[model samples]
Target: MKQVQKIKLGISIGDLNGIGSEIVLKTFDDSRMLDFCTPVIFASAKIITFLKKQYKLSLNFQGIDDPSKAIDGKINVMNVWKENVNINFGEEDPEVGKYAFLSLEAATAALKNDDIDVLVTAPINKSSIQSENFNFPGHTDYLARELEGESLMFMITDTLKIGLLTDHVALKDIASVITPELIQKKIDIIHETLKQDFRIQKPKIAVLGINPHSGDNGVIGKEDEEILKPTLHKIREKGKLVYGPYSADSFFGSKNYKNFDAVVASYHDQGLIPFKTLSFGNGVNFTAGLNKVRTSPDHGTAFEIAGTNSANINSFKEAVFKAIEIYKCRKEYRKLTQNALKKQGRKDTNKKLFTKDN
Candidate 1:
């Protein structure tokens, strides 16, 4: 019998003042989680210890200087910084935000280096995390620059999956930003992600309209009819199973979303509002179409409930599980594709030999 290798799950501790630390600790509190993957937390051991004592969690972690030293079946905390810092719960602090960026930066480096298999990030305060060095609106934008390929903010649960076409963009700019090219590119990304990451052979995708009743043939808004409908039509003509420009208002309410593998929304709120409503505590925000796998809980840093130790750990736990699943899926997809190409190569060779002899 052969022993299987465990995945190295890299974690980036988000805002120190938020429930990020609480959820991370609580999620791995159950020792059984270690059996699935080796968890490497990109934060100081002192901070985690402090958090454990504060949260009164029974979880134990080991300190390591690098991800390569991470041991399987143990919680590994890689110290990205070695300074004593103040932790003010339920408050937005720039100092704490800096630490969050440090953890994220270190974890991202390790991910790029393949030191870790997959990354499961905790929530960060978008406002507090703003600095000259880190000017991105959120994780998706930052990860898009750090990793290869176009990044799509894909929120996923067991049954529902939604991708945003224009994430982190203002509502006013959304209409103007959403062009035929942008729609086509996002559709391509979602289509490939479905087949490669989710292992869907032929994925059927739904695109929500930009306006009410999908603009009612240019009544409510011309964007839906002029841009969205035309773009989707062109994509469908390419023989891909893409459908929509459906009215967003009743798309999920009527359970029309259940018919497709995934749904593409025009903007952030348009997609996230419904997704979070349907699967708030259980949904995982997966950054799809990237070279590396990364996932985070659907919810953000709950500042009001930061230090109460009452933060729900379900989303974070689901994030960890989803990251591992996606990593394995990508690996398996690559192997199958390679084998298929090899078989085709052999067939082509045999045909050439037979043709030459005949």
Candidate 2:
């Protein structure tokens, strides 16, 4: 088999009224993006044209319906929306939601069919893109369904990384969702990603407790002791390096996070609060344990700053770069894994031959 020389990225243009277009334009500003990998965008030709004039960012687009046919040195646009898109500038529109879903659909299809290697997405407006827009709660749920894989909402920075057990779900629904099976699944996903996509040989993972003081020996909450202990036991039995159920309040202060590679939170707020506090606009949202590589910026669609040249492109750049990094890691892992399989195969063949001769 021929080794892949170039990484392919499918870009989704999020809500047009927000800063999605601007970030997309800014991320493509470095022509080096082409040198690193191939870029295919899923959006409208008219929308990108309008964005060029609005942001004064000079970028040429090559129209292609499929990601497999994308060409290098130009933005390959998969135009799912043909109508002239009207941008209300900062105003949210239901049309924006419709178009965002269309773009996501196209991007996702490409990912499943092996047409694209990495899916680097821009921000979107969840509210406007709802039933009034698309009826989906968030990208994590939608993509999880489409990919038919359990999903994880993880935020990463140079300093720290957080994986939320539950994301975008209501607080009321969160406790119900925090089951051992799901927690074990999330931890396994994070561990595998760290090894295969992050090149960590033995990843140290820290699991956060659910309640304050980690349920205070069931005084504060029994969920941590009853629910979490068994799960940790199972994970440890698998020969994985992990420790936790520590007090959520004291875990951050102990500076023990540095001892681990990734932190697993019991809920969304439990993990994200400290993660955003530390990383903020600098963090990159990474979906862990998926067969395909997916990444996005930590921040949301900054509609107010759209086209004002005030939106920060740092997070967008981080997403793009992280996607590339993960791609490389996957490639190296495949190579190593293939070599190991071949080596084992050769040994088996030699053993069989020796036995037959004897």
Candidate 3:
């Protein structure tokens, strides 16, 4: 019998002026969480102490200089910075944003170095976090650049999974951005992700139309009928369980999304709006198709409820759980595939030997 190794969960503290710290502390407050994974928070010990006292949380943490020094069965806070900073609950500050980037950068580096098994990022203030160094629209873009593989913003829950074809793009530009190539790429990514990450033997994917009523058969818009339909047809020809060009307006309301394993939305709000609406507190935003596992809460920084001690921690907790689960699933999927390949190789070699004898 062998003992299972616990996952090293790396956490990046988000905007200080928002509810990121509050929800993080509250989620780990339950001591039972420590049994599952070793949590390493990439922020200063001083900041963690400040947040704990500010929120009056009884959560205890071990301060360390590096993620490798993190101890299992204890909350570990790696001191990414040693300076003491100001704490304002609801105000947006550039200074606070700098520390958020620093935390994320360090945590990401640890993830790349294999020091952490997975990463669960807290919400960051997109506007304030903008700098010359960190110029991406959000985490998905940043992670896609930092890590390998084509990234898809896959929002997941117990039953629903939605992937965006064009995230962080202007609504006006979505039409132009969603070409046949982009559509094929996203569908391929989603199809592989469902099989590899979610462990679905054969995946059923539905693609939402670019226009209302899927261009109403070329009445509302031409993109859905001309672009989406044709590309999806090509994919379906490849023996993939891909369906749709379904009208976005009536897709979810008619409960049509339930029939498929995942839905591909044309743009950001098209997917996220409905996902957040139905699975707000439970959904985990997973960066599928990445070499490293990364997930985040479905919701963003609740700036209004910053230090009110009223922020919901369910989404953050789910993010952590999803990250760990996906890591295990990926490892198992790789092992199974490798074994299958080796067995096939042996069979081929035996067949060649028989042919030679004959």
- Per-candidate clashes come to 0, 3, 0
Q: What tens-digit string does per-residue lDDT give for candidate 1 at 236-281?
A: 9999998888889999899999899999999999999999999889
**lDDT values, one for every candidate:** 0.93, 0.83, 0.93
lDDT of 3 by residue, 1-358 (tens): 8876689999999998999999899999999998889999999999999999988989999999989888888999999999998979898998999999999999999999999999999999998899998999999999999999999999999799999999999999999999999988998899988888889999999999999988989999899888999999999998998888888888899889899999999999999989998899999999998999999999988888888989999999999999989999899999999999999999999999999999
Best model number under lDDT: 1
lDDT of 2 by residue, 269-332 (tens): 8888888787877889988766788999888888877768778888888898899998889989
Model 2's alpha-carbon lDDT is 0.83
**Order of quality (lDDT):** 1, 3, 2
lDDT of 1: 0.93
Candidate 1's error at 31, in angstroms?
Answer: 0.3
By TM-score, is 1 or 2 better?
1
Query: Number of clashing pairs, model 1?
Result: 0
Candidate 1 regions exceeding 4 Å error are none
